[model samples]
Target: MRAGSFGQLTQDKENTTQVTFHYVEGNTETFTIPIPASEFQEEVLQLLNQPWLTFHLVDQTVFICTARLIKVEIKPAIPELQGQGIFSNSMRVSTMQRAAAGRLPMNT
Candidate 1:
């Protein structure tokens, strides 16, 4: 079977979350499949049986590998820590102070 990508989302009802899967590509296509929370593992197994590139949820978006049998990196949707509003100024100040302190040896 040819490897392809799929997307999944989780929803909650009665304090339990359900997972849903959607086929991203194929000839016999299914737009989506809603799976109960209790059946999550089984659903994942079923998808993997097709050897599909599963897109996992990270923060707000889903990320799927570009190819099967290949380790593809998925960059996070969020900005880098240094670029984040909470850390940017502090990071810059710390970096400048460290530079002024001079470059120390690799090990302590």
Candidate 2:
């Protein structure tokens, strides 16, 4: 099994988040994750500055690793919703998309 590495999260593309892994004890391991559009909220953004983040592996095992924000490449344009925006068309779009995908929980 490979030990998870410590690093930061970056957008590898419009639909992917890349995890840059660096090992302090053994070989560094890295990976990427797909996140919901709602992940752009301010609360989540602050999480990027946290010292460490707890991750649950696919095996149900937990991994605690330090998150270092070495740098961030500024994109030429912000995302349509900038990962977070309320009271706008983007919010409406997100809702519609979720409903279409059958992700929105039914009230009854």
Candidate 3:
């Protein structure tokens, strides 16, 4: 697995977010981005409007073609926080809760 500076998916990593890119050719690549929940959402929206996205790694930079990208998955890097946002702090809120608040669909 390719672990980035944002850290890996562990129970203790609540500050990190896991972003997975799915391509049209049935290939997928996952990256960990260390950003807050709101910031991460903004970044994703910006990426969707761009033609290409870049990932700066330790020794190299990876370029992604947005045209061939089929899907993008965003979730907390921590397994225990699966139902919560990136930085939920103390008040834990699940996707269902957010959906009820009209933030997202109730059945996504």
- In lDDT terms, how accurate is model 2? 0.46
Cα lDDT tens digits, model 2, 1-108, are 234322222233544444545545544555444643345332344655667766566766536355434433222223543433323443325767867779656788
Q: Pick the candidate with the highest lDDT.
A: 3
- Give the per-residue lDDT digits (tens) of candidate 3, residues 1-108: 676644554533566677899999999999876775556765566677899888888888999899998888777522233333445544668989877798644675
Against the true structure, candidate 2 reaches a TM-score of: 0.34
Better of 2 and 3 by lDDT: 3
Q: Which candidate ranks first by TM-score, i.e. highest?
A: 3
* Candidate 1 residue lDDT tens string, 47-88: 445544444344434433333322211111112323223333
How many angstroms is residue 1 displaced in model 3 relative to the true structure, after the best TM-score fit? 20
TM-score of each: 0.21, 0.34, 0.56
Q: Give the candidates in order of lDDT, highest first.
A: 3, 2, 1
Off by over 4 Å in 2: 1-13, 36-45, 67-108
- Return the TM-score for candidate 3, rounded to 2 decimals: 0.56
